[model samples]
Target: MGTPVAKIGLVPCSGEALPAGTVCRLACRRVLDTLMSGQTVAICLPLFIAGGEEERGFAARHPTITVDGCEKRCAAKATELFSGKPVRALLIPDILAQRGIPMPTRLRGFGAEEEAAVQAVAETIAQAVEGVVAQAQAQENQHGAV
Candidate 1:
């Protein structure tokens, strides 16, 4: 199949109420700024939740991943409410717990453990982006890119 490059949108929780939320933000930044800069972009959750037409329009076209902080899944819920379904959903707390990484209680007092969690989460997100892009391209090629 021919290579069909696809844009990926990352919507981070960006919640300041909890440290997991902060980790969500940092992990997304790692993806957008370092891991998948060329293939992915960050979608502002504040504006998206506020019904920003541009963000909504972007989601309509690209595959989006919702990076949530806790089990509440605010980011994922908001995205689903405004736009269509997200291609994938990530939870920082869940990831950290699954990886056996302990997290800080405060929102801004993260140390090395938090950093490590962010790194792990970012790597997973990057890999997910590649898979989504590749699958989209294969599907497009099969369907003749209508």
Candidate 2:
């Protein structure tokens, strides 16, 4: 009857171990940016196995877009294991690897360079989610008119 609603989410594979300090916080900011633009987004910080389980449940009920900082695939695996819904995983390491963005040898907090890196990765993930939402809306329009 109306536009198809899309609930988006971003999740990191490892929270505490993230060399980029407050990377999850940065991810939250990216989600906020989407919401500011009149899009809906949910962010779940899975600090432990139990939290991951909860996130998986939330993702199951909604079409969630998960983003991980590395190749650990923790976020995607958790979402799939708990919710049985496969996530559109945005592995930061994979992206950086593709762009030839060098990896930091030492783990540290979010700095200027790391911030920019995360921003790029986060934006890429957001764009993909937007596309999916748009496609779903288009399909709804097509079906409703028929």
Candidate 3:
């Protein structure tokens, strides 16, 4: 039988105080539900931090991408602390700042600006997932060739 494809875990920020946190969650949802779909799995930050064995075990087995809302990097830090280091880490504020997009202010309601941010972040996550998958496939091929 052929080797099974590896899945990438997505860990999004859980902070509700900042609107950027909302963007992180929304963007990750878009990637999980639409953009990357079956290629990715969502890792709940709260559950991971709270010692969810299943969550931690999946993260430990698969590559992970952590999306953080701010500089605190709670998601990234927690994932690293519990399950090795993540394959990729993304910060929404840095992405927005680099792209000249302002942070969304509304926490619950999303406007055009928020939607744009979500799209951008989702695209970024998709790209990261693609890279991780490609690298894994290459490594698998190389090992199979041996």
Q: Pick the candidate with the highest TM-score.
A: 3
lDDT of 2 at 116: 61
The all-Cα superposition gives candidate 1 an RMSD in Å to the true structure of: 2.7
Best by lDDT: 3
Colliding residue pairs in candidate 1: none
Per-residue lDDT tens digits for candidate 3, residues 27-72, read 9999999999989999998887686999999998889999999999
Q: Please, what are the lDDT tens digits per residue for candidate 1 over residues 5-121?
A: 567989898898887777788888889998899999888878876769999888767789999888898888888888878999988777778888787667786677567877878
lDDT of 3 at 105: 90
Q: What is candidate 1's CA lDDT for residue 136?
A: 87
The whole-model lDDT of each prediction reads 0.83, 0.61, 0.88
Task: For each candidate, give its TM-score against the true structure.
Answer: 0.88, 0.75, 0.93
lDDT comparison, 1 vs 3, better candidate? 3
Clash list (residue pairs), candidate 2: 21-109, 21-110
Off by over 4 Å in 1: 1-5, 144-146
Tens-digit lDDT track for model 2 on 1-146? Answer: 54355565555554556653245446556656753345545546453355565565656666666666666667677777666554466777776678776654446555677766666666676677777678778888888899
As a whole number from 0 to 100, the lDDT of residue 112 in candidate 3 is 79
Residue 112 in model 2: lDDT: 71
